[model samples]
Target: MSASKMKILISGAGIAGPCLAYWLARTHLNAAVTVMERSPTPRVTGQSIDIRGPAIEIMKRMNLEEAVRSRNTTEEGTIILNASGKPFAHFEGGDKGGDTFTAEYEILRADLVGLFLDATESLSNVKYLYGDSIKSLDQTEKTVKVTFAGGSSDTFDLVVAADGGISKTRDMILDEHITKNCYNFLGQYIAFFSIPSRPTDPKMWQWYNRPNGLCVMLRPHRNPATVGAYLCITTPARGQQDPAVEAALDEGVEAQKRILHEYLGNLGWETKRVLEGMDSAEDFYMSRAAQVKLPKWTNGRALVLGDAAHATFGVGTTLAIESAYILAGELSKIQSSEDIPRALERFEEVYRPLYTKSEGLPPFFPQFTFPQTSWVLWIRDSLLWFISKTKLYKLLPADEGSGLELPSYGWVDIHRKDE
Candidate 1:
């Protein structure tokens, strides 16, 4: 394998795959990157996600800021409503720059996926395979043979698993002793989708949480006539993966919908209307808050990145984009083909500070996010209200990144002026 002609196979084109492709095809790296997308075409289904923290810096490094901003929902912030539907606590706005619950620069997941595709699709070295997936991975000391679902097999010098939590490669190389099974079961599940928008809907993200660990949120989207609906609550261990994790991985989508209806129907604040429109929703997704742990991200010539190797509570996009940039940056500096393994090790070293076993929320988060009792809910709400009013969170150390001040590796910045 020659350094100039390194063959890199990246599975999953959602966010991480395409991002890795972009960096690999950059003038600095120029590695041949092939992206395998399981979806028949580009993914157009997903709720809104924020490009926050260092991920935003990566976006600017890629010069995708304005292009991403153009698709913003322009959400002012979030309004936490009481059972009576009155405002309880409010966060200014969840955007990339804002330190709200989400991000200040929130956009539809589909839009961000499209932006990545638009950036890398035209690159000469980047190729996208739609409706294809890896069936088997056979890695030797030299090359890794990948068998796709379409009955095609290819060998690549280096393989990257960006396919996400259910990744086949992640399972194959996973040291069971290090990372747990695909389902980490975070004691919470969330179902989110888009529904019809109303003329009188608030411009900001509106949320309602019941003391019994039930939550409903309605958020305005780019389409004036559409709203993003979200449901998340604590539940028993069984049937946790049905709704959001993998589209009821073990059951039917209808079953997932039925479960939602059975449990949430009694709740107020347009729950009935949202459930009524559920079937028509295009991007309904449900998932448990599970984290995939791997002692070492690399195994021989293959490695995992993003959610497949490091599934967290949230920040999927941020982690994926940032890791992609860093991975390519590290690989680009490789002195020769053999230096690749050292680069992969360096990549994990950079991410070790960011990786953690306990993913999501924070200390005593369950008592607040999914309060089991009323008194706890009231106390949690009061604390959040006080924090919101006093702006005291700013007094705490900023969570911009891990405590580690990372070394700056020069990154390629792509710029196109359409404005």
Candidate 2:
């Protein structure tokens, strides 16, 4: 059981990759870890996400709680409004105000990534290669040979793809023919951006639901004069005609604003002001709701972790962080690559049932609803508002707490080993 020697290549540097690198290095001193990121640097802007229950425990294990808390969104709550700017309902903000925003740690996406990058940067055993990605993978009996876009290649004892759910590594290994529909398509498209916080705006979110597949929520930040806007398109599946696209599937800023205005325009409720800020912005994040599902997450010495294997919780950023923690713990339990497939199988076995449900309309929200132009947005907001207020919200498990019995970092829990 002397796991003193292990080498791993983890793909993606966002929440998961760096996390895995940290855990792997911590668990085995002799472990050499390298992470490859497609982006030039860590992402800076992302929606405010709540971390609860087990996930929080994992963060504490990584010793990142204080740093993570410092950058929290600290949302005070939000006011639901009509297209006319008339307020309808309100919801409480982050966990900073008791257990209202879920019984977990909540923070901005960028903040969490920044904390992780900072934690791993000084470790000589852990290396980060930004602006590059795996172009191909060639696996042999004892090693994984990977080719990178930067024309670099390396062989490792194991390869873990903590890359996001729409993982290119998954596509490379599983082959594109396997169209995975595990993602319960919430027919909505989301766009995240930063804009000015006007004096007229309160320290809360102002949600305007005009129907016709359009809903806008403005979340106020900790700083008085800054606010974040999340726009959701509930409508017909819109896309360009040329299907064979190679560019990043991201909707980008200009395009998202164009689509936003096309559907969410001129209804009032600070719409003009919000649109003005968004339109003037240089960048924005736009994405569809899709999850990744794999029949199995391992083939030989390679295993897919986090979103690359099973991405069910929609685009909520905290889920990605949680996935990283769980994967690291599971890997820590395994003795060698010989047990990798079993470890992956066990990991999926433990998590899938807790998340999978066959009730209440697939639990996936579609982007469009015909009567949405009416009061459906009001209803949805009202329900969320109610959940945010009452005990029902508590019933939605706060899985982000920092109390999970994880193995010691840089060392394995030999007692928990699989026989």
Candidate 3:
């Protein structure tokens, strides 16, 4: 495919597709790009996420750093409590890496997608079709023809899947030969929703952990209008993917609330008020905290990015931002159709290790605990509290930017006006 005439079709407009569209256009490609989403409009809301390290640097290149920073979920830090809401542990926020990093520059998922869509709207070669998905793909050496659910078909020089963890495209290409590695299960199911803020919890973020579940709260970033909750319910490994996954997934939003009510719901720290406010939320999200790993990210012209390639539960948004960043960076170096395979290979080679290196760390230390014996749990909790309060963590090297020796690549910037 000639650079001047290359046409590309991308799946999943959520984060990676639109983000890749923005960067591909910035490369001055004499080609055309289109993003097809399964939803009618771009996504409007989702759980909070962060952009850190080289991913943050990529945003700076795209000139979106300021806007992203402006939308951050300024959660000062997390407050851990007992059933009665007494303070047990506190983490002063910074780039201390791991869970605290999830709180860094956190923006609601839908907002991040909107930012990418808005940024690429003006590019002449870029187009987005919502409420549809690719139904079939027929690729020859020269071009690939994509059939959509809406009954339209199009041809392109290449197709990429950034649709996320449960990727249909990845499933098709691998043909069930490659099973996604479920690295470590957090033994938790998380659910969250946006609700009107109450007078009682003003500064944001309160969490409580018990044997079978955990509850967390946060005030929206500079938005006095709402608050958010992150609830995790523990389940046994054999119970992770039940036949009732769909029904259970739908129950996520209320499951946490219902569980909270059953557990700490009576403790009276504004629980009723928060649940009342949540009633008005349009949607509630729920899911198991399981990571997705694959033997490889590519099978011929098909390749996966973001969660589809390496879905890390409890990883928050930073990992997604980094995955998109690395995928796009490697792809930008491709010089021709023949160069594409190498690009995808290098992308996997570059990112998978970085992700592997971060495994086994706590999601929100002092605020969360794995399945430990009662004796071990008490000691670990105490140590976490002492370290958090005494600032002993400052002695350890922050887990920021400790990964790959990445190469520099030009990226596109998209910041809001005030930014």
- Using lDDT as the measure, which candidate wins? 1
Q: Which digits, one per residue and each the tens of the lDDT, describe model 3 over residues 1-419?
A: 34457787889888778877777776634457888888888777678776655566566666786888787776666666664667788775546534462445677787788888888877777888889887888867666788888998888777888887767777755546675453434456666777877666646467655443335455454576777866555544423543344454566655545554554455355556655666566756666665677777776666776776667654635566676667667777776766666777787788878767643344443223632244544666687789778867556554344253556776444332243
Ranked candidates, highest lDDT first: 1, 3, 2
lDDT to native, each model? 0.75, 0.64, 0.65
Model 3 vs. true fold: TM: 0.84
- Give a tens-digit lDDT track for model 2, residues 1-419: 34545678889887778777766655533467788889897777677666664566777767778877776665566566644677655555554334553233557677777888877777767788889999999987767899999998888877888787678888666545553554444455677777888787776656666666666778766656567887776544423121211122344455556767866676666677778888866447777655566666667777777767766543335456555655565766776666665666666665555334311233324533222545565567667657655646444433445445543434542111122
Decide which is better by lDDT, 1 or 2: 1
RMSD of each: 3.7, 5.4, 4.2
Error of model 2, residue 369, in angstroms:
9.0
**lDDT score, residue 313, model 3?**
51
TM-score of each: 0.89, 0.82, 0.84
Q: Tens digits of per-residue lDDT for model 1 on 1-419?
A: 25357788998988888888887766365567789888898879888887766677778767788988889987877777777888877676542224666565688988999999999877777888899888988988767899989999998878898988767778766567655654466667778888998888888888777766788888889889889998876744432433443444358677778778877888898788888878778788876666666678887677888888777666777778877878887787775567777888888887677554224547644436777677877887888789877766545443343333445765554423231
Who is ahead in TM-score, 1 or 2? 1
Q: Candidates ranked by TM-score, best first?
A: 1, 3, 2
lDDT of 1 at 404: 35
Error of 2 at 72 (Å): 1.4
